[model samples]
Target: MSLGDDTGQTRIRLPEGSDGDPYGGARRGGRSSSRSLVTVVGVVVLLIAAIAFANRGGDDSAAEEGAASADSPKAAATAPSGKKPVTTKAAGIPAGFTHDREGAQSAAANYAVVLGSAEMFTKARRDAILRSIIVPDRVADFEAELDKAYTPEFNKNVGLNEDGTTPKDFTFVSRTSPIGTKVTESSADTATVEVWCSGLLGLAGESSTNPVTSSWFTITIQLEWTSGDWKIVTHSQKDGPSPVPGDERASSADEMAKAVQEYGGFTYAR
Candidate 1:
């Protein structure tokens, strides 16, 4: 991932081309590349059609839709009104959060999305990203620990340049999109949330080192509603409840790289 500072906003750049296979597959090229892109596009199209059909049929599953109206800005507004849990942190930014369960869970889910993004791969960018999401008091500690984990050697191993930069011709793509969210436990002030995430990690370009591969992981967060918002107190992750692999062919390095450049990311909220 590449970090750029513009006017004052920070931007994270995805790899320009494809590289190493995180899933341990043989390097794919030529016909294989075209096939992969076609397959992915088809699957996405089918998914959209399926969702349209389901919604049009009035399959009102409350568990999935939660609130009756999709017009509301808050996706989780229909959450259960239980007790208002204790949400303040002894030393962190919880002093600014409101002590409400829904608010806390909302904050935790959004923060988790930011924390698990590709921007976390770079040192300076990673520090800023963490600082923006973590509780105020824990920012220093989190930064120190994260810095230790993101060593120069680690960056190289992950297909980054020694200086944690993306090569000019290559496009490194690391992203996580949340499929859904569940509040497993909730009280007046605390909640345990599970976010199902689909992630892509790879480099794309002619002669690149890391090709984009995909993975699924679930992130669990323990949250407390504090000050006036939700704050994450703890976080953990696990491999996945992945689906079976389809027989689609992989895309070429150049094609994948071009797509990355053409596309952008979204700001997700629960």
Candidate 2:
């Protein structure tokens, strides 16, 4: 390096090299790399957006399916308000319930539960209860039969009082809960229904002869919709495919009584 005295400018000299491409198009390579990175980021964004859209669509489909199931043929047909009064005469009696097939079925089903209830084994309350549900014409016959069936001997067999009462210091728990309902047949004026039910009938008390027990049964009822509601013309029952026993400790009479008093029964509809 040397300095020029005219303006004190410094200069340097080097060996000569081959001439190559000018304008330094190497900037294009950097730009290309940046473009590739942007493309990758854009693809990732698109993928995330697509996934979100798919999940939202799936949720909507599930909601629609749930709504459809609640309104399906089985539910609709079994519901109580399907038709007008369907009346049928039974056993020389002008006994006909409403043709509200579903309503009739439901009433018959629930009435079966009420009739077979432990309450029906009693005298004073039983007749009143039956009169409320049974065909007005057949109420007397049903009451008479039930009274005869719940005899003193039968009470002893079930460890109850001869007067159709729970023994002193004992708690009786008898209940029926419907598992499901089905209509086997339906016409303009008649329908047959089957109701599957689980029930409990037993004594719960310390030193109680009849400790709490449960039973499973299904009841089938032939119903005719008459007047304004469902009434049973016939009812039948059979044993069940019962569950294995559980090892829960039984409650005392006082506890059972208190629980029953606190709990309420449902006014079941089809």
| Weakest ten-residue segment in model 1 by summed lDDT | 89-98
> Per-prediction TM-score, please?
0.61, 0.60
Which lDDT tens digits does candidate 2 get at residues 126-233?
877765656577778877787788889988777788887887777777788776677788787567787778887777777877765668777888765555555656
lDDT of 2 at 218: 77
- Model 2 error, position 3 (Å): 88
Model 1: lDDT to the true structure: 0.67
* Cα RMSD to the true fold for all candidates: 14.0, 25.1
lDDT of 2 at 178: 73
Relative to the true structure, candidate 1 reaches a TM of 0.61
Model 1 per-residue lDDT tens digits across residues 133-164 = 55567778888887887788877776788777
Error of 1 at 26 (Å): 38
